[model samples]
Target: MRRPGSGTRRLAGARVPVRVRGRGRDHGSAAVEYLGFLPLLLLVALAGVQLGLAAYAAQQAGTAARAAARTAAQRERADGAEQAGRAAVSAWVAQRSTIGGTGGCPGDAVTVTVTVTIPSVFPGVDAFGPVHRSATMPCDESN
Candidate 1:
């Protein structure tokens, strides 16, 4: 049908303009979405860091156990055996690992057991518990 603009004015009066509905262009939509998801990203990053730290601690524990066992097996049950082992591994660890035990690793067949309590990066969350790493080495029987 010819509209009034085309010189045909019949049906209704002047045609009412159709209003565009719904939402307009969201200029800040991406920014808003990223802001909403930032917290989750940060949490994941912190968890990753915590996992790395735990793994490092576990490796250090194993190193300490091996070193202690080797030293104690051949040594004369000296007082510095345990301290040396603890220091050797603490060089890599966070200096917070609890390393100590009786001179049980001073026999022909020495066994050193290292235990470390993993620290948490996130509060109130314990992903990995205490880790225990042990090593045993035969003594130098030749004295």
Candidate 2:
């Protein structure tokens, strides 16, 4: 008689095959694992893209605010401040953006604020909101 997988002993009549643990049950497990991780991978990708969009929106808001404030500071820029603000940002951002200002007088300081909505790149996710930026400049008193 011989033990399974034991070379020290010899069998006289017949041979026996050794059974491996988890050999049959482990099939297709890799595919299952990949499927389980698919959602998490998708989440990470979406988060990365959404973060980029939010950052771009914030940058655009700052640019718009600066342009608007600069124009508002000029005494003759009463009607052009908003236009400048809108023009300073990307068209997609401008479509969903708002520009406003306060305290731009001949002798008064000017403050311009720009707000842009940060669009979500992930489907069914609306956690991100609008980004706001403000700028101030001295009004041109020489007007």
Candidate 3:
């Protein structure tokens, strides 16, 4: 016979109910809920990463533009402005970037424009567009 208030009940020739400590009907519910919410969490994380990538791409574009403009401002280095721009950014960004502008010391200033495609964290998704940045530098007449 089980003691009173022991959290067990027994009927005639029937199984008894045993109560486990620190366990209830809601046991493992949190895990189930977490599983249900896992997708959303991952999506948020990916979105944050994608945002960071886009920002980095924009920054890289600006850097590339400045570098190209600086190089183009010098008549002697004008021919290598595009190369300098590509070399200013990360290889991955450089591979997906385009640099163009007016150089030649013909004008008082040299302008360079750089475009970098924003990378995606998810494959087959290209919703994020390219980032464009432009920079201008005074031409060096001597060079």
Candidate 4:
């Protein structure tokens, strides 16, 4: 037997309270949990993007270094090695990069070094520093 408008039911003439599962007690819990975890998820995503940017910057630095070294190896283009290095990378990367090197045609080889600051996704955060890459090329004996 059961009573109307009551949570209890009669079993063998004894009243027992009905136990409810996953009712109003847990309402909106998922939304709350998701809200709590949202910040962490965003942070992880931002970190991944930042890491990718750093890798790109490193790759750009390497390209710049190689371009500069190759240009410096030729006596006729040695003076434009820095300009050549800057032109080899993206505008954004070149804007924050520095190129320096030694050696030229008379020498056995030419070496060039490029340093670029890693761009940050987070404002005012510089957790990752500059990326540096160096390259060497044989001098052009004919030049």
Candidate 5:
């Protein structure tokens, strides 16, 4: 008996509610909440990436150190310990990584150290220091 969308449904003497609202006071606030939380989301993502980079750097350092020690342990390969270590790692990492060694096979054992800078996920951020790993191998009898 009422016209379509008459804009109002007036009863005898009271005005009827025309617009339906959600039961909660914060209805339709999903978009606003997400926008407000965007910074936190970005921060978490960057932290995850940075963590991965640090782990990778540590692993690379270990690998390089082991390779260097092994090479140095061999009398024939002692001269190329550092080079062997560098060759064992990825080019990018080797470029940024530093290699060192001490206690050669000439004495009793060979030890090598690898230090790799932790790459950053965010530009211009170098808050992290280098990852270090050391390896030692018994010297070959010939050495």
Candidate 6:
């Protein structure tokens, strides 16, 4: 108990200590993480796409080579071989894909080549030069 006009300890007279609690500061954490991981993510995605494209080009090349060989054996005409190879590649791949045929029938193996434009998703990389695929098959005995 305190008397009047005397400064005594009271409930209101005691200083209330303030302890400030706040959430941890995260300034652009997500952005920083994304920036750090962006290159890896892009590399993986690009590699997957490139591998798929390469497989597809290889399949097209095989198909074209087989078809050209068959055509060379049957028709024994160079034009027919070229046409067959082009047809086979065009049926499965884009028109931009290239198809070339060489060689002859009767002891000659027909060669078919397929080429495609590699996508340049990566910076400062040439994706168009080494994109060629080739396959060769022996002509049948008919021609």
State the weakest 10-residue window (summed lDDT) of model 2. 2-11
The reply for model 3, stretches above 4 Å from the true place, is 1-22
lDDT of 1 by residue, 27-92 (tens): 689899999999999999998999898988888998888777767776566445577678777554
- Per residue, candidate 4 scores C-alpha lDDT tens digits across 1-143 of 64444477689999889854545577899999999999999999999999999999999999999999999999988988999999999999999999988445667988888999998999999999998999989998884
Looking at model 4, residue 84 earns an lDDT score of 90
Count of backbone clashes for each model?
0, 0, 0, 0, 0, 0
Predicted structure 4: lDDT: 0.89
Q: What is the lDDT of residue 81 in candidate 2?
A: 89
Alpha-carbon local distance difference test for all models: 0.72, 0.82, 0.88, 0.89, 0.85, 0.64
Tens digits of per-residue lDDT for model 6 on 73-92? 55447557767777876554
Q: Which candidate is the best by lDDT?
A: 4
Q: In model 2, what are the clashing residue pairs, if there are any? A: none
Candidate 1 lands at a TM-score of 0.73
lDDT of 1: 0.72
Which candidate has the highest TM-score of all?
4
C-alpha RMSD of candidate 1:
6.2
Candidate 2 vs candidate 6, TM-score winner: 2
* TM-score of every prediction relative to native: 0.73, 0.77, 0.83, 0.85, 0.80, 0.57
Better by TM-score, candidate 4 or 1: 4
What are the root-mean-square deviations of the candidates from the true structure over C-alphas? 6.2, 4.6, 4.6, 2.9, 3.8, 8.7
Residue-wise lDDT of candidate 5 within 1-143, one digit each (tens)? Answer: 65443446589888885644444557768889999999999999999999988988899999999999998899887888888899999998999888888445867787888999998888898868888999999998962
Which order, best to worst by TM-score? 4, 3, 5, 2, 1, 6
Compute the lDDT of residue 104 as modeled in candidate 1: 51
- Once fitted onto the true fold, the runs of candidate 6 whose alpha carbons sit more than 4 angstroms away are 1-24, 76-78, 91-103, 108-143
Of the candidates numbered 4 and 6, which has the greater TM-score value? Answer: 4
Model 4 CA deviation exceeding 4 Å by range: 1-7, 17-19
Q: Residue 39 in candidate 2 has what lDDT? A: 97
